[model samples]
Structure formats: C-alpha cells, structure tokens
Target: MTEANLTYVNGEPTLRFERRLRHPPAKVWRAVTDPAELKHWFPAAVETELRPGAPMRFVFPEEAVVDGAWDGEVLEVDEPKVFMFRWHQDVLRIEVIPDGDGCTLVFSQTIGGGRAGFLAAGRTAAGWDSCLDQLAARLDGTTVPARTDWVTPMAHYIEKFGLGDGTVTATTDGYELRFARDLVWRKPADTWPVLTRSLETGHVTKEEPPRVLEYEWSQGGTVRWEFVSDPKLGERVELTHTLPATLAELRPLALATWHHRLELFFAAATGGVDESWSEDRVAELVKHYA
Candidate 1:
C-alpha cells in the first residue's frame, strides 16, 4: 500500500496520498469522476454532475462500517486535471498530472480539529487506502475484492499515527499484554499488589474485577485490560492502549517501551525472571514490529 503522509493545510490536519498509475490522465480522470467507472472502486455511490458548486450525495454501501449518506458540493472541476469536493465537513482534492504514457495522482483531504479530527485521520486514511488499492486494481484489469475488513487497516493507521488500541501480542511467545485491563482478578492474590503498583503510574479509568480494568497514562493515552478464558490457555489476558492523535512521532518509542514493560509484567505475573528483557531485546522487537 502507498504510505499516506500527515501535514497541516491552513491550520487543519491533512493527509496526502500519491500514486503513479500506468494509465493516462484522461483514463484516470474518467475513473475518478465517472460514476459508472467509480462504482467498481470508489467507496460511495455518488450522484451529481461534474461541475463547480454542484450538489452531490454519497450513499455508502450497506456493509460499510460507517453507514448513511453525506451531502456535499463540488468545490472545483478542472476536467482531466483537478476534481475537488466537500464531503460532510472534509475537503477532498484529487489532482492528476500527465507523465509520459502514465499519470500521477495526488489525493489529499483536510481533516477537522479536536479529538474527532485525529480519530478521523486514521479511519479516513485507511478507507482511502483501500479505495485507491481497488482503483489501482481496476486500472490494471485485475479483480480486487470490495473493502469489508477495515479494522485491520484502521489499527495499522492508528499505530502509524502514534495512537493505538494498545494490545501487543507475540504469537511466537504465546503471550500478549494489554494496558487497559487488569490481571488482578484472575491471578493469585499475592500478585495483586505487584500488578496494581505497576499500573499505579497511570490513573485508573475503569475497573470491574477479573473482567475489565482501564487506566489513563500520565503522559498520554488510556490502557484497558480484559481477561477471558481461552479453551487452550485457560484464563488469558489482553491489553489495549489508546494514545492521543497528536503524538505521531512517539509511536516507535511508545511501542518499544510498551513491549519492554509487558515483558516485565509477564515475568512478574508468572513469578519467573525474563533475562531477555534488555535494551538489545527491546530494539530487536521494535525493529521486528517496524
């Protein structure tokens, strides 16, 4: 997938995606603006004429995670070159540039402000990522499945932006640690204080003994722990950490730190020492995740 970069346009957060397609500008333009061609790849069913100030309605597929329709106006329409539109409150602009026998597509969206804007950044980025993937497939004359699984990609974008749902699992290690839940209810009474003290650095957000425990970190984000009885592992634990949207640069460090902490937590919970929990080990794990 093509990586999307985050930037600010006019004081609003923006996501920019670029792609070099093997198709010509006219063909790419038709694929983007022609409703008939759009249905094969575009997420929503658009209804409107391609002209400036034209009203448009986007009807989402029934299976979409975000259901319902949104109304907007065509902000600009420089045929075969630029197509800009407003969807809800966000502005989407697509610019196509001719390059030899191919063309380059530059897509950008202006995100809103506040927490909602941060959250939308990931969702919108992932959604467009999938749509563009489909578009590429369409241009290549290959079949690409419709987007049905958004959670995985959304999680990716969330982590990419330094905010996470906060669960890290090492399938090879047969262990997972999550910060949002508690290990106290299922573990031995002797381990309760250790677990509680380890989590004391963060403010408790929710607690429901042996089931759910949530806390907000002093630096940023929230952690939630959940316990479930797996048939294979008996009582299992899962942790989720949610970080704020503004800390994109800290994602790598945050992931490494969390991995180290979880290793410590695992050792403490099991009453066994993890000698492998070292700077080198953490670096290796971080590189593996990266």
Candidate 2:
C-alpha cells in the first residue's frame, strides 16, 4: 500500500493515494467496477452498469453496516483508464496508468468544508489506506481478515497531515489521547494543582471532582483530563489535547514539547522521576519526529 498524500485544493482538503500493482490495467479496472470483485476489498458492495452517467448504489453488509446505501452518479467512464463518480458531497476519481505488464492506480477524494471536513480528513485517509491494503492482498491471492483496527493507522495519518504527534484513540473536533493509566490513588481535583504547578502556566477551564478537569494551555492548545472506570485497566485517567494547525517547521518542536510536558505530569502524579527526561532526550525525540 502507498502512503496517502494530503493537500488543500481551492481551500478544500483533498486526499490522494497511489498504488502500483503487478496486474494489468484491465484486471485492476474490473476489480474496482465489478461488484463481485469489489466486495472483497471495497467498503460497500456496488451496484451499477459500467458506463458514463450511470447511477450507482453502494450497499453495506448487515454485519458491517452504515445508515443506508451511498447513491452516486458516474461522472466519467473511460474503460481500463479512468473512473470518476460523485460520492455524497465529495468527488472520487481513479486513474490507471499502464506500466509495462503492471499498472499504477491513483485514487483521489475531494473533502468539502466545515468542522466535519477537517476531522474527516484523517479518518477518510486511514480508511482508504486499509482498503488499499486489502486490495493488494486480494490481488496477491492471499486471504486476510477484514481490518477492524483504525487507531494505529489513523495516528499515522494524523501525524502525516501535520496535525499533531500523539496516539489518537478517537478524533472529533479534536484528537483523543491513547495514553490511559490508573494514576495510583489520585483524584482529578488533587491532580489539578499538580498539573498547573508543574506546567507553570495554563488556567483551569472546567473542573468536576474525580471526573473531569480541563485547562487552557498558555502555549496554544486545550488539555482535558478525565477519570473513568475501565474493565481491564480499572480506574484510569484519559487526557485529550486540542491544537490548531501550526507551521510545518514548528510541528516537530511542538510535538516534542507536548510529549515532554506529559512526561512531567506523569512524574508529578506518581512521585516518580524518569532519568531519561532530559535535554538530550528531548533532542532525541525531536530528531525522531523530524
């Protein structure tokens, strides 16, 4: 599978992916257009005639279902070369370039505007990443289970898009942290002062004893801490950070700073000192992220 490339086109977020397969253009084209072959890898089972201006309906399985079928119209159909369609408010395009006995497939989707668009960019890219992986497996004649884990790949996409560097368990208006641990016997109210004092800045925004505490970071983000009961981890603390898009050059530094601060928070809460927490360690982290 190829890495998804994200860019802004006409102020709208667009995601593009390319894959080089050993199969010829016609074999790849049929796999994308034919419903029987598509069901093996595509998110939905497609129904339509192979032609331009044809109406298409995408049906999801009962076990892995969505709200309803995705209805779309084929915009262009140049056999074994290009297939373009209108999917919801987004345009999906596929181009096949012959490469000797093999072919390269380019897929692009234009994501529209609003709060949802920004949030969906990472998710959509990750979904396509998995689908393309599955497509590759199918072409290679290997049987693999459907992918149910999106957290790992979504984190990669989030970082690739220069949003932030953290393990994202979930993403809505902002990204959710993947770190969750039982903080020994500490409660949210008791934790708040330690967090504030250690950071030396940031004011508390919302505080609910033992449950939720939120604060605004002086640097440029909001941090929320929540305590919840987990079946496996028992009582655990979850932290979430929301940050605006920053300049590309500053992303690595910003990510390292946040990671370092989180380390400090953990040390303060546990009364444990990490010897690795030093300038050299931070420089190593910056290099790793870079």
Candidate 3:
C-alpha cells in the first residue's frame, strides 16, 4: 500500500495529507530530505537542512531552466517523525510516525487570505500533492509517470473549495428541510402512467435511465429539486418539489415525499405500486386498459 492519504477539506480550504511508509525513520528521513532522493519525487532542485530556524532553499532547476525558485523557512524539525515549515505564506506540517513494520508520514497546510492567497494555496497544495504521491510510490519501490505537462480542469478544481458539511439542509419561513431517502426509478411498463404523467407535467426536467432525474418544487417561493436514480434498474428518476404540503412537513421530509410519489407514479402502470411491473408488462396492460 502506498503510504499516504490526501484530502482537501472543503469548507475551510486547507490541505490535509498523510502517508504510511513501509520503511523506518532513517530511510524515511533520507527519502524526504536527501537532495538526490527528493529530486526523484519532487521538482528538480537542491536542498540544505530540515532544521529549525534555518533558511532552506529548494530550487526547481526546471523553473530556472525558465527563471524562478521558491524559498521558505524551516519552522520546526524533529528527527524521523515531525517537520513543520512555512513555505511562501503557507503553513506546512509533516509528521512521520513508526507503525507496525514501517513509518507513517503526514503533510498538512492551511492557506487562505486574498486573491493571491487562493492561487498560491491551490498551486502549492496541488504541487505538494503530486510530489507526495511520487514520494509514496518511490518508498514502495514503484515507478510513477511524471505529469509535468498536465493541465487540471479549473472548474473541477475550484469545486473543491466549498467545504460545506456534507449534510444538505435549508431553512426559511419556519420550514427546515433535509434529504431523507433517494432512489433511482426505471421504466417498468407497470408504471407507465406515472412516468407519462411525470414527463408530461414537467415534473421531470431531465432523463437518462438509471442515471439521473431532477424534480422541482416551490413552497411559498422557496424552491429546490431532489436528484434520484436506480443505476441497477437502468431507469432512475428524481423527485423535485411537487409534493403536497402535508407530506413535505414530515421529518426527513423527503422520505414521505418518496413514499407518496412512488405510489402514485407506479399506480399508473401496475394498477398498484405493490406489484412488480416491467415496461413490456405494463405497456401490454396499459394498452388493454386504454
């Protein structure tokens, strides 16, 4: 196993990284600071000491083979397990601990302040992330292809900036809401009417069987949509804000909505929601009923 985990905390724009090395402190230490070894995983450059209060210069020779270098200070350094530093306006923490048959290494950074702050933090974080992955591969005696020419999608990268608690909740005018249960619906002929009505009434704005469905809702001006899918069934539909108020008021409100919607939706195809209904099966019955 490669000795590292990298995570970008969404809300508070901070980088949290960790790695478990299969080697001892001595070997891990050398891999981190030895100029030759560091170059294997990091940018082509040179280094001085991993010590406290010392000015260490690591030049990305490749940058100078163009024209620049990043300079920083070594804030704290302890043999084998911990190293802390400040690099170009960011706080960097590195931790190495002895674990079972090897060592664990961790790197963390917190950077945020201004326009330059975002750019600097992002670049620094991604650069370190790629470099650390290289470090892990090297320690495990593996080879990694260098991605020097790669360009990251900025939108996708920027999306990582939002660190909202994964919980979805919204409140307005005494209505507090959250997602209850989400399901993907498939085209079961037994449920044709519901599907037909759903599509006809604009209840569904998008469709890709088993992929996604978007349902819209509006209550006294507040509006949002629930996304759903049933990948296994190859037909998935999402329920949006079309449920009656009585059902919407329930705790985990979405659950009640699903129960009510699914029942009505399938009733059109299966004569009832309790029985299994396939598209062909329902279609045959639907034609007879028609």
Candidate 4:
C-alpha cells in the first residue's frame, strides 16, 4: 500500500492512494464495493446500488447499526475494473487491476474547495488507510485491533480548559467530574466550564471534541469519553459512555461514580431507576458499550 496523493483543484480538495492485494478480481472487487463485505472491516452499514446514478450512503453507529449516512451519486461504473462516484459533492475514483492472484486497488478523491478543504481532504485519506488495513485483516480472517490513541487528545483538552486539580469519579450519567479548586465561575458558554476547567485560580483550558486533552498529574493519564449511545429502556433511558481507558483502572471508586451518573441520568430523565446498569447486568452493558 502507498500513501494517498492529496491536492487542490482551483482551490478544491483531492486525495489519492494505491494498494496491492493477494486476491482475484472478484474477491478484491467484492471486498471494496460490497456492503456486507465492508462491514467485516469498517464496522458500519454501507448502502449503494453499485450502478451509475445510484446513491451511496455510509452511516456511523448508534444502535449497533448506522445512524447517519453520507449520500452521494455514482457517476461511472466499470465493474470489477474501475468505478467513480460523487462524495462530499466531489468525484472519487476506485480502480482494481488484476495481478497474478490478487489485484491492485487505486483510490482517489477530488474536492473543489481551498486550503481548508485540502487539509480536510487528508482526513478521508487517513480514514482510507484505516479502512484498507481492516479490509486486509478481514481477508486474512484475523481480528482487527481496537484503535485507542486518545492520550494526546486528552492532554490537549486539559491544558486548554484551565481545569484545576480535582478527583474524577466515574458516574453512570457520564463522568461526575467536580473541580474542587478555587476559581471564579465566569458567564455561560465558557469553554472551560463546558469542557474541562480548574475551579482554583481560574486556570482553565478548553479542548474541542475529536481533539486530544492530556493531564500529567497521574501517569495513567486522564479519563476520556469516546462514543455515547442513547438507548431506550422502557420509561427510562440508558446513556452508554465509551471511555478510552479500560475497566481495571476505573474500578472501586471510579466505577461506582460512573454507575451513579448513569443512575442519576435515568432517574431524572424518567423519574425511575434503570436496573439495566446493575452490577450483575453491567457486563452486558459494557459489552455493548465497548
């Protein structure tokens, strides 16, 4: 596999990449173009007609399935050889060339924006890298590793919010994060209060989502919430928070606090206790949340 070449066309964004795989045309073609086959790697629902002028959609997870999707039209189709489609309102081409047993897959995307768009174009390029790796692993029938590179983003968030030294308790509602430091509470919409902040000395730094925030006080680093799932539980509701760290470090105090948050959210939301988060039942919840 080779890195994608990214460029801008008249201030537009574009990305391109190439990969060689050890499979025949049919195998390689299905791997890249099939929705069921893609799920084994990317873990998302894919919808497309595999024909010209048809719409394609890739949705992220919410309820063990896709919640939102990107809708685009297919412009060209040369089946098992080459195909082009419209993504982000731009053109994307994918080509497969047969080798001895496998084939070479070449992918490219073109966007009509500027520098900002070109920078953003790199995101899809990286995403392709991840997705292709998963595809390879799937072809080999191997388990894909969970991506857990959250340390940098966590540290960045801590510094930006000016968050003070405070103990974090794992709560079920989310994370019962209370800043015990002495600081003045500024007006509403303060990034510090909403994200992370220090109540003492008014030292606060805010880190945006999908961005890293770090804390050096503990070598173990700070807790981070990744994905959130809102599930229906009869009259109540269960908010599942996927923290970056594992269950071992969050045990004892932290675990209890997290449970409390879940309880609070459910009780307040529907005026009742949600038994799904009970210790005996948490294993199941963790499985889904993980």
Candidate 5:
C-alpha cells in the first residue's frame, strides 16, 4: 500500500489509498464485501445488503477504538469492480481494477465539509492505512500485529497536511498562542470536556458559540481560546493568556507549560500516545523561549 494521499474537493477533504493485491479482483472483492472477511480488516462490522439505496449500519467491534454505530446508505455496487457507500459524515468508495494476474485496488474516502473531521485528516488517514495493511495480510492468509504507535505516523501526516502549526510568543501583556488543536469531530460548543480533561475548570469569564471563549485561570490571569477557520489549514485554535508585565521573568515557565499543553491536547484529541509531563521536557522547551 502506498502512503495515503490528501486532496480537497470544492472545500471538502478526501483521503485516497491504493494497494496492489496479488490476489484476483474477485478474491479482493470478497474481502471487502463478505462479512466474515470484512471482520478481519474492516474498522467496523458492516450490516447491510449489497445493493444501492440500501441502508447501511456499521458497529465498531471494539469500543476502545470507537463506540456506538454510524448509519449510511449504499450508493453503488458493481460486482468485482466497485463498492461505494456513504460512511456517516464521509463517502467511502472502493474500486478494483484488473491488473495482470492480480488486481489494483483503489480506496478513497471523501470527507464532508465540516471543520472537525478534515482537521484531523492525518489521524483518520493513518487509521485507514493501518486497516489496509491488515486487509493485505488477510488476503495473503497471514496476520499483522496490531500497531501500537499512532503518534509517529500521525505526526508525518500532520506535517504533510500542514497542520498542528501552533506557536507561542511573549507580548507586552503576557503570552499569545496560535496552534492547531484537534476538536475531534466536534465544534467548540462541545469542547468543555476536552478542555477540562487535563486542566481544571476555571471560572468561565466568557462563553461564545463556535468561536470565542474566555475564563479566569486559577494560576492568575485570564485564558481565552478562539477558533479560526482557514481556507488551507481548515480549523485552528488561538489562545491568549493575560498576565502582568511583572510576571515577565517567568515567561519561560509559563510559555513552556502552555506549549506542551498544545501538543498534549492534540495527542489526546487525535487518539495518540500522550507523553508524560516532565521537568526535563519543559527545560528543553524553555531554551526556545529564552
């Protein structure tokens, strides 16, 4: 399988991957369509007839990977050639083309025009890539060990997709931060759970929908978070922590903590490994601010 490709279609995002299977298209089609074979590789358990316009339901096998079910409709079915369906918020299309003795399978998912999903394309594509790897192993009558590390590949996709570009700068007032934060699949309206997951729920000074929020920090000063949608980067978070100029001497400590918090929030949001906080890590980052 090749690296997943990313592209935008009329302001929507799409992720595509291609795999060269040594098996015939018929065999591959079964792996994609048959419930038994699908259980080996598909991310969710599929429940639907193989026909266009049929309602489709997908229930995840593992609640840890994902909980609950998603509903969609089968869009098209061309025997041994094509299978297309609406997958919740995205459209999933799979195509198998005849290639000498084997087959070339093209799988693509078109993301809906939403801010949350597209922003985490890296994580989503990496997840699908892992599933495709399993599909290849299943077709070959072999098994693949489950991947334990999602952060490394996700970082690659994040950079490749030009995301997670958040920065912190010291200012006359205090500190300013601009970083890409994953809202998971939610807008800022449902961000309280994420915000209070690691940090305490300070007094909410201001609360706004889909855009702005502010709160009084327990550590003194005020914290504000803003959501901005960019045409290229999709959606991002901008934070401002207001402090007095007398606190300038502690810029390194404050900025380092906030900087690491950015990545920590991102990892948790994207379902990746979270590094434990340490003084050494903060000290290393402090050099940048100094």
Candidate 6:
C-alpha cells in the first residue's frame, strides 16, 4: 500500500492512493469493477449499474458503520479501465492501468466536509488506506485484517497534510475558533475537570452536565465549551470566547495561550506528556490566528 498524496482538483482537496497489484489488468478489473468481488473489500455495499447515469447507493453494514453516507449516481465506467462515482458529497475515482505483467490500482477521493472536512483529511485518508489493504488481501487470497490500526496512519497524515491547526474568525462581537486537533479518541464522562484544570478560575455562568459549560471569565467576557458527540470518542470539544471591548487588543494573546493550555489539558486527560510551553510556539500560532 502506497502512502496517500494530497492533491487539489478544482480547488478541492483530493486524497490519492496507488497500489500495485501482482494480478494482470483484466484480473484486477474484475475485482474493482465487479460488485461481487467489491463486496469483499469495498467500504460499503455498493449497488449500481456499471454505467454512467446509474443510481448509486452505498449501504453500510450497521455494526461497522461510520458517518453520513449511502447515495449517489454512477459518474463514469470505462470498463476494465476507469470506474468513477459519487458517494454522498465526494467524488471517488478508481483507475486500473497495466504495468508490466501486473496492474496498478489508483484510487482518489475529493473530500467534502466543508471547513471541518478539510481538517478531517487524515481521518478520511486512514479509512481508505484500510479499505485498500483489504482489497490487496482479497486479491492475494489471504485473510483480510479484521481491525485496522487507525491511530498510527492518522498521526502520519495529520502531520504530513498539516491538518492539526485550528481556525480563528473575527466576528463583530469578538473572536471564534474551530480547532483541528484529533481530540476524538478519548471522551471523559465529565469534561469539566479538563476545563477547570485548563483555565483554573472562572465563574460558572451556565452548566449542562457533560454537554455544555459556559463561563464568566475573570479577565472579562464569556467563554463557553460544548462537547459534541463523536463516533470514535465519547465527544469532542467546541469553544466560543466572547471578549470584552477592553480586551479587544488582547484577543490574539488569549486565544494563543488557550491553545497551549488546551493542549496541556488534553495531554493530561489522555495521559500524554506535558510538554513545556514556549513563547515562540505561541507567537507562531498567533501569527496564523491574528
């Protein structure tokens, strides 16, 4: 299995994967194009005619399901050469080319999660990696891996694709941020401990169990945290900070500092090492979010 390459097609991020199969082009074509063969390795139960303008429905097995999916029209089919289709908001393309006596399977997908989806490139890539591995196993007549290790490949993709950085927006009232960190693996019953531990002191303005927590900041304004449910993790955090007019000039600093603090808190919760903070690191992040 080759490492995925991130490319852009019409300003959309595309994850491309290449696999060299020992089988010939005609043999590989059946595995990729035939529905019966695809059932062994393909992500979902693909149902559609082998022609363009045909309806496509990606039915997932209930127990091993992931997220929003299961419908599209077949885009193209060049018979034993190219197979392309739409899977929800994504455009997936599969190409089979002869290489010596064997063949090459080229798979690429155009991601479609909006801003959040852009940040989830690694997750998407890791998933396809697992699928391709299964395809290889089936072709080789070997037992497919029952469980794919997502964490190891995801970490590589995040760093390689620069998906760990969060985004900051300047609103009329103040600043809003959406983090791109992979904080989905571990979700605590009560996230308040992580919050209180991160910020230390703040008057509680709103509290709603393990879901929402609003705060009246000691420095002024409001800081709210929301724990959204995630499939892999119990929940993921979303933060909104409203700064007082007086703190307008300090918005960047506050956000940058919180970025570091949040990292510390996440590390603590996940039993990861507490790395020492650096002004240089904060300054660099502020430049991006400023």
Supply every candidate's count of residue pairs whose N, Cα or C atoms clash at under 3 angstroms: 9, 0, 22, 40, 1, 0
Question: Which candidate leads the pack in lDDT?
Answer: 5
**Alpha-carbon local distance difference test for all models:** 0.68, 0.67, 0.50, 0.49, 0.74, 0.73
The TM-score ranking, best first, is: 6, 5, 2, 1, 4, 3
Q: Which stretches of candidate 1 lie over 4 Å from their true place?
A: 63-70, 145-152, 165-290
Cα lDDT for residue 180, candidate 6: 40
What TM-score, to 2 decimals, does candidate 5 have?
A: 0.67
Q: Residue by residue across 1-290, what tens digits does model 2's lDDT show?
A: 66899877787778999999999888899888788998988877777777888888867565233325545778998998999887656778889999989999999998753433444465578888888888878888987677665545655675577544445433444444333433434556666666555555478888776577788767666777777643212234566666554523444555566666655665566454432457875786689768
Candidate no. 3 TM-score: 0.47
Over the stretch 1-290, how does candidate 6's per-residue lDDT look in tens digits? 68899999999999999999999888888898788999998877777788899987776675343433445888999988999998767889999999998988999999875655565677678878888998888888998657634555666787688665555677776666545454544554655566555565488888886667788767777777776765522345666677755667777777786676656555555444445678997898688658
The lDDT of model 4 is 0.49
**What digit string (tens of lDDT, one per residue) describes model 5 on residues 8-79?**
666678898999999999999999988778889888888888999988877865442343554688999999
Supply the global lDDT for candidate 6.
0.73
Residue-pair clash count for candidate 6: 0
1-290 per-residue lDDT for model 3 (tens digits): 33222355555446676777788878888887667887888665645566687775656544333223445678887876677776555567778888888987877876644333443333444566678878889888997887653124221233254211012234443333332221123244333335544642335455444334444443322223333323221232333343444443433433333334443443333233433434554344334323
Task: Give the TM-score of each candidate.
Answer: 0.58, 0.59, 0.47, 0.49, 0.67, 0.74
Which is the winner by TM-score between candidate 5 and candidate 6? Answer: 6
The predicted structure with the larger lDDT, 2 or 4, is 2
Tens digits of per-residue lDDT for model 4, 1-290: 67666555555555667888887888878887888887876535778888999987767565333245455678888888988877545677789998887888887778543322332333345566667778878877786686554222222222233221223456553343332111111211322232233211121133344232333213222443221211211111111223334444443344444444333332322222233335644453344334
User: Which prediction has more favorable lDDT, 2 or 5?
Assistant: 5
- The residue pairs in collision within model 5 are 166-179
Q: Model 3, residue 14: what's the lDDT?
A: 60
Question: Residue by residue across 134-158, what tens digits does model 1's lDDT show?
Answer: 8999999997777665555654665
What C-alpha lDDT, on a 0 to 100 scale, does residue 164 get in candidate 3? 10
